[model samples]
Target: MKRTALSAAILLATSPALADTPNTDDAQTLETVQVTASRIAQTVDETLASVTIIDREEIERLQPQQFTDLLEGRAGIETSQNSAFGKTSSVYTRGTSSDHTLLLIDGVRMGSATTGGASWQFLPPEEIERVEIVRGPRTSIYGSDAIGGVVQVFTREGRKGPPKVDAFVGGGSFNTWETGVGVAGGTENTNYSLSVSHFETDGINVQDGVGDEDRDGYDNTSLATKVSHRLDNGIEVFGSILYSEGESEFDSTEGDDYTDYVHAAIRAGLRLRLTDRWDTELSVSHSRDENDRYTDGSFASQYDTKRDSVDWLNEIFLTDHLLLTAGLDAREDRIDVDDPGFLGAEEYAETSRYNVGGFGILQADLGRHLLEGSLRYDDNEQFGSKTTGQMAWGIQVAEAWRLRASYGTAFKAPTFNELYHPDIGFFRGNPDLDPEESETFELGARYSVEPGYLDVSIFETRVDNLIAGFAPPENVEEARIRGLEIEGGYERGQWLSRASLTLLDAEDRETGNELPRRSPVTARFDLDRQFQRFSAGGSVIAKSRSYNDRNNDIRLSGYGLVNLRASYQIAPEWQLQASVKNVFDKDYETALGYNQPGRAAFVKLRYQQR
Candidate 1:
C-alpha cells in the first residue's frame, strides 16, 4: 500500500500541464534566493522544498524584540516562551520535537549537545543580516538532528560602497531599554563589519502562586565582527565571531534563583577557486555555552559545554546542467557540569563525545525538470554508524506553476543528559537508549505571477524509538505527524500583503492521543502601505487550542493577537519607528502557567548612512 501511494504521488507530481498562461503586461517582481534547501545557492523557485527568507529590510520593519518574536508568524513553525522577554523558549517545526531542528550560523553549527537545542534567546538581532528556514527532513545534506528542518542565520557583512555607520536607542514598558551601533564597509579586496548591542528589561512576575513577589528581570550584552579578504589569485579568507553574556532572574522553588550565562562562537574559513569547474572550501569553528546558577547570592550549579568542528567541502561543475558537491565534517563535544551536593544521590561531572560524517549531493536541471539527490554517513563515538538519503523531483507544469515531491530519512541521537545523568529521586537516565529515527514524504506546488507568488505543501512524518522521561529515560514511544502549509505574498504600487496558514494532525501511535503542545491550526496575516518616507502596517496571528501533557487531559485555550507598526524618515539619515503589540491586551498562555505579555508600546530613534 505504501509503495502504491508513493508511486501515485510521483505520477501526479509529474503529470502533464493543463494550460500555459503567461502574463504579457509588464509588472515588478521580486526574486527570492535560498541556500539551506540544497546546501548550495539557488533561488527558491528552483529549489524543491518549502523555504522562507527573512531579509534585513523585513527584520527592521518587524522590529522583533527577541529571536522567538521574529519567527512566530511563519508557516510550519510554532514557539512557546516561559515569559515575555528573555526566558526559556522552544520552537517546534512541522509538529516535531524542539530538538529535531538544526541551527546554523554562517554554515557553522551553534548549540549545546547536552541540551540538544540552541540558545536562541541570546542571539542578537542587531547583528543579523538574514535568516533562511527550510521546512522538512534534511538529514541527507546535514547529518543528524534535522528531522524537522534547518534554520541558518547569516551575520552582517560588508557591502561594496562607502563606509556606513548606524545607531539606535529605544525604551518602552517594563522599564526596558535597547541600544546598538554598527559599522560596515568594503573595498575591492577587503571587507569588514562590527556591531555591539545591549538590552535590559525589568520584566514582570513570571511565576504563578509563588512565594516571592519580586519581578524577574534580564540583561544582555553582545558583540559581532566579521572580516574577509580576497587575494588576486582567486583565493579568499574570511572569519567571524559572536559573543554574548547575560544575567536572568527566574522563579525556582529551591531559592531566589538567577543565572549568569555566556554564549560564543568563532569561525574561520578559506575558499579556493581551483579551476573553472571546481571550487573548494575549508573551515574550522568553535562554540561554547556556559551557565552558572546562584541562589540568594550563593553558588548553586554550573554547566559548560564546548564544541569544535572542521569542514572540508568541494563543488564540481560536471556540465552546464549538472552539479556535484561533497563534504566531510568532524565535531567534538565536551561538557562539564558541577552540582556536587545539589542532588540527593547524583553528582554531575564531565564527559566528551565525537562524531565524523561524510555527505554528497547531486543536482541536475533538464529543461523544465529539476532533480536533486543527497546521501550522508555518520560514525559516532557512542552510536556505531548511521546512513541517510533523500531524493527530490520538480517539474514546471506551466509558465507560472511548478510541482515538487520529496522523500527522506532522518535520525536524532539521545542527548548527554538523557543518556548519562545519574539517578536522583524519581528521575534517572538510561544509558541503553537508542537513537530515534524518522521517515518523511512531502508534496508541494508553487504558483507565481508578476507581483506575487503562492506556495502550498502536504507532508507526513513517522517517528520510531522516541524517547520519553517517565521516572527514567526510555524509548517506548512512537509518533505520526501529518500537516499542510500554505503561504503567499503580494506587492503592487505602495501596498503589500502577506499571509500563511498551517494545519497539523500530530499524535502518539501507542496511546492514540494528541501530541503535547501541538496546535491543530495556526494562521497569520499582514498588510502594509508606504507613502514617500512614511509606512504603516498591521498584523494578525491566531492559533487553535492544544494539550499540555502527553495524556491530552490538560488544555490551553486558543487566542488571537493584533499588532500595529509605523515608521517615518525624519531626515535623510534619521528615522522614527514605533510599534504596539497585543493591541487588545488579550490574556493568554502559550505554555501552561506562564502568562504571555499584554498590550505594550515602544518607540525608537535611528541614524544610518550608506
Candidate 2:
C-alpha cells in the first residue's frame, strides 16, 4: 500500500511536469475556495475573505530550506525565531499575537493545548505539496485559535506505478549538511509512499559573550509515510504518520542552560463517497512533545506533554452551486512541567476541549457576478458556544478587470499557558478572561495582461478583547486592534516579480499606547528569471523597528536580508541546485534580545527516474 501511494504522489507531480499550469481551464480559474473558509468548499468569487495559494512548484523554485522561511515577510505577516534550533518559532499575522495564527497539516489542526500555537520546525520542507493561506477571520468554520488567519500544509501523496525513488545530499557554509530520500509505487487499487530527511548545522554566535561562531549548533531528523487502498465498495481507506526529532543550542546568560527539544506525532484518516455529490471523512491523531534545557549541569528545566484528537466531516451537495457541511471535533491534552526557576516546585497540569460544530454555505454564479454566504456554530467546553458568519461578492467587469469584496467575523480562546502560570510564589489563572473576537473587511482587484498577471488588495480589521499581559494594578486588560493592509504583485512570462508592503497601527484601547513588539512597517520583494535549463532568483525582506517590552521600555532596530538561488539541469534525470542565504551577512534579530545567523551557502545534486 505504501509503495503504491508513493507512486501516485510522484505521478501527480510528474504528470504536469512539462507545464506549470493544469490542463483544465476550470482549474486555472481564480475562483474562491469554500473549504478552507467555511468547512464546505465554496468558490472564493462569492465569499468575503482573503486567501493565497502557493503551489509546490513555487516552493521548489524558491528553495526555502525551512518551512517558516516560505512565509516570512509575506503581506501582513511577521515571523519570530529567537533560537538557533527554531524551538520557539511563532508567526503573527495582521498585527495579531503570535498564537493567533492557526496551522493545519493535511487539513488537521496542529495547535498545542499548552501554548495554543503550532510547532513550525517539526515538518520537512521537502515533503510539502502545497500551501494555502487565508488572512482575516475564519473561526466560523475552523473553531478557536484562528483569530488572525489559517495556514494549511498539504503533503505529497502517491500517484503513479513501477516503484520510483529519488535522493539528494548536500553540504554548505556554517558546516550545514542535509540529505533526503523518498520512494513510491504500487499495484492497482493500492499505493504507498515513504520519505526521510535530516539536517545539521554549526551556527553563528550573534552574542559576543555567548561563545564563538561554531559553538551554536542544531540537528533535526524527520520521517513520514502514507498508505492508501481503494475498497470494492468505492470507499478509500488511508493512513499517514509523521515523526520528527530536533535539538538546538542557543546563547544563555548563565552559560549553563541552552535550549533543546524533541517531539513525535501520528495521524490516520478514512474517506468515502456516499453518492456522486456527497462525501464523508473520519480522522484521528495523537502527538507527544518532550523538552529539556540544561546549562550548568543540574537540569535547568523540562516540559512534557501529549495530545489526542478525533474529527468527522460530512459534505452534501444540493447542486453544483450550493453545498452544506457539518462536523464535530474533540481533543484532550496533558502537560508536566519541572522548573527550579519558577517558584522552585514541580507542577503537573492537564486540560481538555470538546467542540461540536455545524456549518452551511450558499454559492451562486450568474453572468459576471458571483455571490457566497457562510454560517457556523461551535459549542466548546470552556468558552461555551458562539456563532460566526461571512458574506462576499465578486464581479468580472471585463476580460482584464476583476473585483472582489468580503466581510467575516472570528473568535479565539486563551491558551493554557496564558490562563495558568506559576510566577515566583504566585499562581495566576484567568477564569474570567473573555474570548477574543474580530471583524474584517477587504477589497481586491486583479488585472491580467499580456506577459504578466497583476493583483492588488486593501483590507481593514477590527478586534475586541485583544489578549495581553498586564501589570500589578490592572492585573489584565482587554484591548483592541484596528489596521490596514495593502499588497500587490505581478508575474511576467519569463521575468517574475512580486512585492508586498504592510503598514499597521495597533494600540491598547485602555491605555491608548502602541502595542508592544509590533512591526508597523514590513515589506518583501522577489525577482527571478528562467531560460532554457538554468533558473535564478533572489528575495529581500525588511521590517521597521519595533517596541520591546509591554511598557515600551526599549526599542529594537530593524534589519534587512538578501537571498539568492540558482538551479541547472545536469541531465534528463539529474539536476544541480545552489543557494546563498543572508547574502550580505547582516547581523539581525527577529526578537528583541536573541541572536540570528550570518550568511550561508548550500549546494545539492538530485537524481530522479524518468
TM of each candidate vs. truth: 0.94, 0.87
Measure candidate 2: CA RMSD.
5.1
lDDT of each: 0.81, 0.67
lDDT of 1 by residue, 1-610 (tens): 1122212111111011001111111111334545677766555677899988777777788877788777786789988888767787778899999889888877767777777887777777877877888999988778888999998887877765678998999988788899999998878777788999999998877877763666788888989888877789877778888888999887774457788999888888877767766767788988888888877767888888899999888777788777787889999998878776546446543388899999998888788898989999999888779999999999999999999999999999888878777677676667778889999999999988768889999999999999997457899899999999999988889888888899999999999998888899998888888989999998899989999999999998999999899999999999999999999999988889886778988899999994
Q: In candidate 2, where is summed lDDT lowest over 10 consecutive residues?
A: 11-20
Give the winner by TM-score.
1
Highest lDDT scorer:
1
Task: State the lDDT of candidate 2 residue by residue for 1-610, as single tens digits.
Answer: 1112212222121011111122111121343232355444333333345655666667777777778888888777888876444446888888777778887766656656666777786667877766767787777667777878988776655654777887788888778888998887666777777888898887656455654333567777878777777789866667766677777776565454455666555667777777766677777877766677776545777766677778777665576655555566677666667677763763433344466776666656555877767777887776788898878788889987778888888887766655555444344446556677878787877664444444566766667776665321112454555555555455556777667777777766677766676788888888888878898999999988887766666887888999999999889778898989899999877776677767878898887666
Query: 282, model 1: CA deviation in Å?
Result: 0.4
Name the lDDT value of residue 285 in candidate 1.
Answer: 89
